[model samples]
Target: MPRAVAPRVRRAPAAAPARPAPPARSRRRLAPRFFRWAVTLTVWGLVAGFVALIFFAWDLPRPEDALAATRRPAITMVAANGALLSTSGDLYGETVRLRDLPPHVPAAFVAIEDRRFRDHMGLDVIGMIRAAVANVTAGRVVQGGSTLTQQLAKNLFLTPERSLRRKVQEALLALWLEARFTKDELLTIYLNRVYLGAGTFGIDAAARLYFGVPARRLTPGQAAVLAGLPKAPSRYNPRVNPSAAVDRAIEVLGAMVETGVLPAAAAMAEAERIHFPPAPSRDAGWFADWVRDGIGDHAPPTSDLLLRTTLDARLQAAVELRLEAMLASQGRAAGVSQGAVVAIEAASGAVRAMAGGRDYRRSPFNRATQARRQPGSAFKPFVFLAAIEAGVRPDDGVADGPINLGGWTPGNGNWRSRGEITVEDAFAHSVNTAAVRLMQRAGGARKVGAVAQRLGLPGPFPRDASIALGTAEVTLLDLVTAYAPFANGGRRVAPFGIAEMRAEGRPIAWLPPGPTPVITADAAEAMRRMMAATVARGTGRAAAVSGLAVAGKTGTTQDNRDAWFIGIAGGLVMGIWLGNDDATPMEGVAGGGLPARLFRDILETHRGRGA
Candidate 1:
């Protein structure tokens, strides 16, 4: 043991080479350096935050400006008789008060949209975290964290553009809104300004639009349905996707139960009873669409407009019904898949009724105003009119035999033409060869086209002889308008729809100017007499209504691709067209058949009104 101790002492004395001393920097304490760096980072972060706030707040919308923002004007279209036809653009109902609403209505929205709506200042921090976690877990945007106040801010002051800058502005606006109003006030504004589906805005409008009821009368189930619309409105629209809408409403009811807004039993009962009213029949949509499209020409874009349109609600309904019924019953047999109907008041040129297609839900092509198809023999009237102006009378004899002009040979529909016939008789029978000869006698097809253009038909009309036989394509609207002078005693009628327009209960200085004279009364009378012969004893016999004087022409294109009847009856000028969208030939569908019959049916319903 003594030897071991001496050896240890000697080894200690011999001490290992001293280890190198730590650097001066390493010797200093880490706490102060860490504090300095932390302070530096903190100051930079504060500066960045200040710059971000300034940049985002630079263009912040003022509260008053946002409150008084201009939105697309809401158009309320009424028939000539003041019956509600349709609404377009942003449809806002009466400004509803929170105190007046059914408690369940606001509660339903709160439960589904924001559970802590009452507690949150504007942004829901806890909800944002929860939504973040849920979204990450589900790998999609499974939840939304926006409070109702925030939503209101977005709808009021911001575009739907998704960007950090927009979100910051939305947040700032939401804070402003919250600070300026109470919870009830915020909710009231939200309900009055939110967008629902089908071009509706505000809870009241949505209520009336979806359920045909006022906001105060909303049932719990209906309230749930409306509450569900704030998220993915089109996807959950009852009119567009009822099943998805019902499911979403049920989810809303369940949320109400979870949020203590409704008892579980009551919520379940409400879910079971959550059936939507059948979507309001849009029978007048064609007419409404036309009026809406043309409204801009009459009135400047405003916040709210009430249009007293030229549409006759009763006539419009009957026209749509008759057209759809005819297409349903006889369309397949005639190989016809689509049809259009348009009726214009003779004196004012107001479009009283319009059915653009057999089923508007299926196809909305406004064949009456938009589609240009060969009018066929329908163009003969203009030819005859030109001939009459060229010193030819209705009784003048014209050759109806086969004729060759400039390498084009035109023939009658029967393929056997009478050698010679009076101009009136030839017109009634829609003899193609006779029309070409009349065009030649009337200074060629150019003269006939000029006559048509003078009568409100837009044209750089074909200058060839085939134009006399309606080889030129023309819209049913223009053709019908051209025929209006025959009924209105030679006055040219510019087609009009809006009878009056009011902005926010104030009448706008808008009225369609009166028509001007385009043709002589004698010429108009002669043309009427010829067309009267058509309805009385010729191809348009099917269009004759009992006790009503009717004048019209029948048109059948080559291979029967298009069948048309444009007529004047009961002080109205009407046009009908039946054809396939693909321009395929129909099964022997002549204008004298279904088209004339449809005209007769429509005229029968509105017999003495227009007259």
Candidate 2:
């Protein structure tokens, strides 16, 4: 009883103080710790925002003139210097409206490449976040969640270099582009600029080159083939790798079905019937190369152009056929293995036919327009035309004897003199010594060079004694064009092939008529008559046409390294050359032999307008 009382008293005494029961202040202090944390976090956020502002303000690329050239849409017009080679790869890229695309094309692309395209505004936030997380987890960029708009933005204004700065720039440009253009407009620009396949730059070109059909005419199967090209055109080239391309196109067709772009049966049919015909592999590689060079000389290389050419399919085929036949017929006896043929309209600068070699696949020398080779007596026309202009006539007498040039002695091709002869006989016989004497009598080298220049020779024509021996190297194009004045009745119609050019249905440049008279009518007619005699009974006798009036000349360079037959018939000026690129001697070959025969065969075959 006593112990229980004592314990109760002691407990009551302790309870009396209660230790003041920890004050409310201590409990309240816990809130301050949380408040400090909140304040610290708030301060840090403000600091980060300020730094972001500074960076954004300082790191912007200034608006530049680099974009100035884009204000007016780039338009390119391509035309040939001679005949119509082709009118295929023409592009006047205006933004193609999404509505204009086969409808299913863009729909299929959206389904295959970007399903969330309709919901996004240039960027897919969820997709981006997911991709970023995945990249971080994988420690590499295994996924790219770029939307269609973003891809277009990068292609249009940014390079392929990868960096955080470029990524940021891409985002900025994408946002800006989205703000300025509608989905249709943006889609259209992308479609027009996107590379399709082959050497094509757009869906339109790819359609034509691969399918031999226009984009507007593309079927579902063909559309799928084109759609498959964006991933890797070269790797999945329908022309080079049809099986792979077909497999890839089937995937696109499947996407089309999934996206309701095509019915399932239609998609199946398209996938099953996915036929990709190989593109025509042109054997005229040299001709194509020459065409590129000619255009590049007058315009920049990157110029988006639709060139009109003067190439006649028929004439080109004829030239190629005749050349191959001639080379083959020569067997080993004709040691020459290279040749070129060029044909032009005498009244206009229209190039009708051009062949650079026997087979452009084997060689692309483009000897017709680019080769600088000795013309031999083929160049004598210019000298003779010049002499005629300087008061010498076809009937004018000149000594066909040994001629001496400044320490250089020139002899006839046969090393035999024809004594005194008419100017016509001198030209027809191609008497080198007499021609030298005539040049000396007709104001020497400078006058002959000037005459060649005036006649469109683009001469660096040699002004030495050997000039009469056709020592000056000249392009077949230049030589044929230089002879154009005589064929054109004394007017120099600068040789050209393109007829009319159009881009987006608008006329661009139409070739005007060429220069005025380079030689008097009398002189031209006299030279024409002389050259006609040459074809009729002289050196070019092998090139004579049965019914048509023809004028021509024959030439063979020193060591028989070159043989040339240049002439005009039925208003066409044609030049042909047979030679070796290595300057190897040709056996039993002369201008009047295989070259003249080939020329005559071509002329006879392709003489009429119907041809």
Candidate 3:
């Protein structure tokens, strides 16, 4: 009986219905878990899509009345309360309609850029996705997803920068353009708004630039050439690269033929008839360049502004005449090749006359505002001002003999010193030893440095023994700015060129008078008197004009590498410098000579001086 029970138990153990195979609940549990995960992921994706849609929809530029070329660039710099100074940047011709332009002109661009331009709405999503995929595969920007309308929108309202926000804006604008304008009208607007090479804008300007013909007169090959430029303006210029442009023209013609807008035979005929015009004149002066580049603070990149600067046309002409005459008379003999003059209204800090170089066409470097040369003794006015601030009289006594300071030796231009002299005498004669002793007595070189900074010496100013002898480098403009306080009885000056701004026949801005006081009236008057005495009977004597009392200082740098004269007239102050751009020494020329004469001429003739 025990054997039978054991056998039955052993067989029955496996037959417990295999526990019903756990009722197949493993897959059921997994199905619910997978469904929950799917639902959660779908919700998150929808939320993300909603957020993205809102982000792209908000803050779009208003498309109302934007159809006109209101955003066209026009920077015109007028003189201060006077005439036009200059005009720079892109210059556009009149806008043209598709009916006005030859059919091939727009046909060429459309065939090459977008074969289905007429079929798309504001956006061609399929084409854009295809282009995006192609660009991604290429790993560079080989293809552009932007339509012609998109490009027009970018030129009209956006900066030339690439980013996600900009791209979104570009897309929105493209949609606006597509919704508002017909295909032909859009092309017309694009023809007017695009920036072509060599500062030319619009299809009319481009046609004139590349073919010496109007937009309506462009031959098919010329049209193709201009069309190719939207991809790269300067690289495939027909005038610059004839063979390469012809090759690109061949491709454009093939596209035209494929799009059925042109027959291969006709396109080939145009390929042979293409002729490039001569390049237009790109001649510009330093002042024009400055106006173009320096109007950013007011106009900025988004606007096309008309700037009115504080330049006096009469003063500018006089300065040019005097500078040219002086250079022609004495340049070769004195071994001087270049010079600059900067004049500012004493009390107003308005830049009136600026001649940055002898020949701006040859070298566009602006010496008046950009070039930094050693001030030499021209820096002594600030030192003397510091002494005056420290309660030292203009007639105070100081040693003029040789002196040593911390292993550095400094000396005057002549290397010989008058034993003892009054501060006024030392300053007038430009005695280096006396100036150094006075700087030490006025509570060290740092005080002198402070005085220079206070008087508007935009620095890189050095505080050392050599500084007392005018060893620091400074721009002519800064020197003019520093000397303005003495002319205005202690008011600070920041030389400014912009006087007003306008845009599209409307007054947008006017510069207000700025008077920042940094010194006492007594100190400025005392310094002015001392400077007048120097011009009256000292090294700055050449700057003195008949029947006109002026205050001035002469500065001759080491080995005559830099010569400077800063003078203050009735209502204007000016600084003049003569030197080689390479800083090579002249044949013993001194600031008391040519520069002083230049100062005298400027002081006597400047219209703003009102003398």
Candidate 4:
């Protein structure tokens, strides 16, 4: 015990090096207090900022004048040189009050956007925190967390940019808005000022754009879709992406059910009955969209506008009626999901009628002018025309059989290998091998592509052997316009939709006729004779009209991806294409099946009833 006590005392005697000098010790102590003071100043600075912001917002714009001078879009379309076809932009329907809206309308916005719309002063602190946590956990920008008032404020008086300044301004404006108006008044302004997709502004325009109905008549599902569009207008637009839009709408509907804004069973029913754009009535659906796209956007006018279009009202109506009826009857039987028809006057190149689909509202996809489809055998005409121009006669004999070009074998429809056949018969029968061989004799795809270009087929024509068979995709408008040479005796005419444009009351512009010579008379006559034979006794027999000389060709792609019938009737060039949007193979469909019948029906109406 004595030895241990001595050892312990000795160890304490060997003292550790005392920390450092007084200066270092005091410096270490000073840091923490300085940090505390700095934090306190930061807190005070934020409080000062909050006070300054409250004073700064005293001069903020009021809510009543928010929309007073706001620009409203108004674009008008006319057919037949000045008959009002449609009015699209700023398409404000009757004024809809929040009190009058189907309760689901306002509720949908609340469910998807701001559940605390009524309770919160403006910004939702709880929702913002929740969204922040969720976004942090998800490692992405998942939720916007912007309340309805915030969105309304941004839309009313701000640009769509993401920055701290913008966020601060949005919050300040939102607070001002809440202070100025009651919940219902704010919702009314929001519903009346929100921008939906497809160039639409306000719930009224959105309802008309998506469902062809008024805001007052919005279904629960439709209202949910409108609510979804505010998040991403172009992304979830039903017209652009139906499946995506539907998915977004389903999320909105779920939000509604969770928020007790809509019943589960009612939501289910509404979900089941979600027909986007709500079965469009007889309106210029796709053509109107096309016209609007052609000319620059027009501002809403104080007076009715007049736009002189190339569309023949009678023909347009008949084309739409027949196109819809055929889809309902013949098209369904033929397993067709979509169809487009473009009729143009051969001499003038004026677009007479355009039936882009069964319903424009259901699908505003303008297949006629927009879609670039493989013409298949329909492209054989260009080959034949090239051959004819290269001094090959319509009666010239060409071998027809299996054609193996660069390891790619092109097959005929019937597979009946006629060793040799007349050029006219080869074209009429749509002999693939013969067309390829003829294309070779006519200097390959280069000459054919040049001929196609001359006939108004704009191209970067592929050099592969498949181009001989029209494997390249081309818009129906281009194809139909190119076929005009065959109808107008070698003159090329571009398809035109606007005859004249008169804004307000004065004429802004007028389109005069422009026809250029593309091919020789002999070549045109020979091709016309051959095409006439196609309608007379070959694959296009179904397209023949009584008492009217019809010259057309039938096209059916490999695996039946596309069916097309393009022809000329009494100097009227028309084309019809039937297919699916996904380019899936059709069942038991040929150019001669539904397309030919539709062509014949339209032609008959034109000749008989003067449509």
Candidate 5:
């Protein structure tokens, strides 16, 4: 019994009753732990944000580098009449100051581009919110939130990319710019550096390019047009898309009314008065490109240049219109896809007008200067001229019948030869065999080549007898230049485009050397008479302009791959070439059919204007 009691007593003490924690104690314990967790989360969030900011700002461009950026040297081209023809490189007009601009000019841009420009510091939060709401409602992103300063920052120092990082950097750069520059100064830089369109890089250059006036002279309507360009430079370009530009300008005018910069009636008036000058003739672009390529030869390459060229704008327009009309009417039907034209002053050898193709946008290859093709019968003139130099008369008898020349027999265009004809008749009719005989009498192909070189045809002419039938390749420009001596009474003149090149208002001495005697005056007169006879009663009859002395040659290559008419009229030497770019045969097209008629039409259209 004692042993049992001792074992029972080993359960010694009874445990204390379990108790639940109070609500106040539980809350007090959780408060510190929750606070510590909150602190840790907040600190990590801040660190992440700082890392993101650094990631975006790491590659931000230096602000000072924006100011020191250099552009390619600008080339501004003007016609002989001082009218702007075209511009290449970075065409920035004279630096314009905001203070010098009309109040309405800046006001128009501010109203359309950034209504809150004066009220905010670059980052327009209200505008962003409003634009966001509007875009969300429209569902197609119909609104933009960028401030004018932000746009300037992106244009000056950033690539045009859309991403979160780019947006963040643009915002930072905008804020920095706003702090560093006054509002007016920022606007001045924007107006001076923002690209408008058509190779122009400023409001002033755009104004001159579009309206033929400076920025200071822009009307309200004109200013509205310029103000609309920043949205889409090429789309709203007044020169490229006038209707789109006008519609955009009308929107700008309406925005001006909304922003209280212009009254409703004034905006309506501006909409009604908005006018864009007719775009510059694309025909001039060919000549402009040629001058631009040769500009380095005349002026120092380091300076921006203004080239005053001898281009006759009126004649250029006429020639282009005629060529385009003719090609449009007949090119497709005849399988002709290309044409080129070159006109030069017969006395001074100045290129007055040039059209490399019917439509420059379709083909930019300068066919008149760059493409070298066989001149065909057009080369016969040089052969005949050589004969004249070697004591042959225009009336001298020559056999036009089929003849074999070193196993290569050449036949006339009609494939039927006139038995015995005067050398003038053989040349006028483009007789192939007679030209070969004349080449033989003129001491063969090499002798004729030397004569052509002296007369301005840059030639590494062939030595074969077939060279008499224009087997030699040459450019339309070279052929036209070689024909100039007859028009200018026998003086050799080198072809030139730039009359004067100026840098910083100082003229660079680039005058072409004076003309020299290349052929005897008597020989020149005889050739002129023979060429005139060819136009009057021979192969080039289609090239004649009524009551105007026109002399020219017709050239039709084998299979009609090329057709050409090189002529002189109104003291100008002009050349026309029609062909397919791949040298495919046309549909029975001959030089006498379309090319000669185009030459005649151009001459007639520009007859009385000193063309």
Candidate 6:
């Protein structure tokens, strides 16, 4: 206790000034200099990078050859005069030379898209400075500050990657563009490269695609619509986002008014008057898919391609409307269902009308071109055609009594047989047993298969007697094409879609006429006679065309899984199929019922429309 007391009393301290830990003044004094040094280093690094970028830009290649390398297939929409006849994007690229681009078009672009475009050396310093300040304050990259040349550079030489390296590449390409081309040339590249919506990539395509007019004829309002697209095409595309596009068009008009390109009152009036043109046929969805597949797979590689397809736009519209109405009548309570229809020009290979499915938005399988299902009784015509070709008279008698052949006794719908029926009567009543009997008598199944092959159907018909009962699978297109011979007096015609393809401004290729006959005129005539009898007094009676020479047959597969009506009236050969994708049987639907009714409605509508 004594030691602790002595320790507690003992400490005396020597004190100097309270320093405040050197007042933190040293660090404060050095920080500014250090920061300055850091800034200077950064500036120097940026300068060095800029110099390196300049070197890269100096050596960059020209835009013309690079663009040519892509050989982007020209815009290929099926159109008569820039009016889309269908909904799918089948266009290849079609470039118009810079000189061909309207002068006003470029002027409008410069006025709204860049404004100091001609004077700048691929960069606008003032605009850049403004963008920089704005971005700095906003804390994000907002304003692009891209000059026309920069835009051209990005479009021609760089991808849309968002990175420092991509920006560097874009800048380098822009400088290169400026060095290699004049302002006018760069402007042209920019005009051609810019994406104007509605599947249009250039001014020319946009003018033609959206307004159904040439760039030279674009009014101020249309020009504004084109100008407004570079911001965000999907948002401003008149075809895709019409309301937003109208708003953007108004904004563009305001910009035009401010720039003195358009009078204020004029801009306002035109903005109010601006209206989008009607879209191409909503029903040609199936046609477009068929066109795309036809070109991508079988079309020859060429600079310009013109595809002359067998599609009749008016007829297609009629088919679509009829199918839509039929579906509506069926109601949603019918559960999941789908349907397909196709029509061919009797004299030409042209497809008159086609319906791939009930709803393309829900499914793009295109049953007309892609689905392969049993033709059921629809296969009877081919068998009949083959029998006729094989010299079997339509009135020739075939016993319909049930016969056990190889343990498979195919019979009529009721598993019973109508004995000693003529071929014509048997086909008219859709007697399966009679068809099997005839098929067995006529070289088993090979005769039908041979006849199909001879008619230019895609290869390998099924090797079963049931094929005569339409048990073999076939695409609607193939079936239609094969039937075209009968309607066209036995001449086989290839089906096509594109009419012609052109380059920058010139035709590259024009589809010439298809090849000649595959079947004898005599055989085709006799077959037509037999098929005509089917519509006149057979299962295809519902599809009969009133006051028109119509020949056709109806098919119903097992369990009503597939129902089809293929027919020809005057110059049109149409095929309609009704079913589900999963092979589910439709409710009380038969080829002669719903499918035939839809066909008749479409035919009658087109007949009235005078197409």
Count of residue pairs whose backbone atoms collide, per candidate: 0, 25, 0, 2, 0, 24
Ranking by TM-score: 5, 6, 1, 2, 3, 4
Candidate 6 accuracy as lDDT: 0.74
Candidate 6 lDDT, 1-611, residue by residue in tens: 56555345756787776757755889899999999999999999999988987765664556677776554454355643334564233243445666665544665677767888878788888888988999999999877688888777776667677877667677767877789888877776777778676556678778777887777677878888888888788888898888888898787788777777778898889888888888776557778777766665343454444443456667777888888788777622343277788877666676666778887777777889888888888777677766666667877988888878789887676535656878888777778887777776667788888877777677567788877877667898788778888888888777666665444346655564675787788878777877888888877788776788878878778777777888888787788887778887777677877777777888899889886
Candidate 1 has an lDDT of 0.86
Error of 3 at 598 (Å): 1.2
Deviation in Å, model 3, residue 281 alpha carbon? 16
Clashes in predicted model 2: 25
Local accuracy by lDDT, each model: 0.86, 0.75, 0.79, 0.83, 0.89, 0.74
Q: Against the hidden reference, what TM-scores do the models get?
A: 0.76, 0.74, 0.59, 0.59, 0.87, 0.81
lDDT of each residue in 1-611, candidate 1, tens digit only:
55554344333456688889887777587768999999999999999999999999888888798798777888888778866677877899889998898889999999899989898899999999999999999999998888898899999988899999989999999999889999999999999999998889899889887787889999999999999999999999898899998999999999988988889999888888877665534756777787787766666666589888888777777788788888888978888988988889889889988887876766666878888889888888889899988999999898888788768887676746668899989999988888888888999977888899898888768878889878888888888888998888899988888888888888998767688899899999999999999999999999998887889999999999999999987788999999998999999999999999999988776654462
Q: Global CA lDDT of candidate 2, please?
A: 0.75
Better TM-score candidate (4, 6):
6
Clashes of 3: 0
RMSD of 1: 7.1
The C-alpha stretches of model 6 lying farther than 4 A from their native spots are 1-71, 79-104, 132-144, 164-182, 281-286, 295-308, 331-336, 389-392, 396-398, 414-419, 462-464, 498-523
Cand. 5 Cα-lDDT = 0.89
Positional deviation of residue 584's Cα in model 4 after best superposition, in angstroms: 2.1
- lDDT score of residue 83 within candidate 4: 51
Winner on TM-score between 2 and 3 is 2
Off by over 4 Å in 3: 1-72, 92-284, 415-418, 510-513, 605-611
The Cα error of candidate 5 at residue 53, in Å, is 3.7
Candidates 3 and 5 compared: the better one by TM-score is: 5
What is the RMSD of candidate 6? Answer: 10.6
Q: In candidate 4, where is summed lDDT lowest over 10 consecutive residues?
A: 297-306
- What residue pairs clash in candidate 4, if any at all? 74-300, 210-277
lDDT of each residue in 199-290, candidate 3, tens digit only: 67888867765666789998888888888887877777776787788888888888888988788899889888877654422222555665
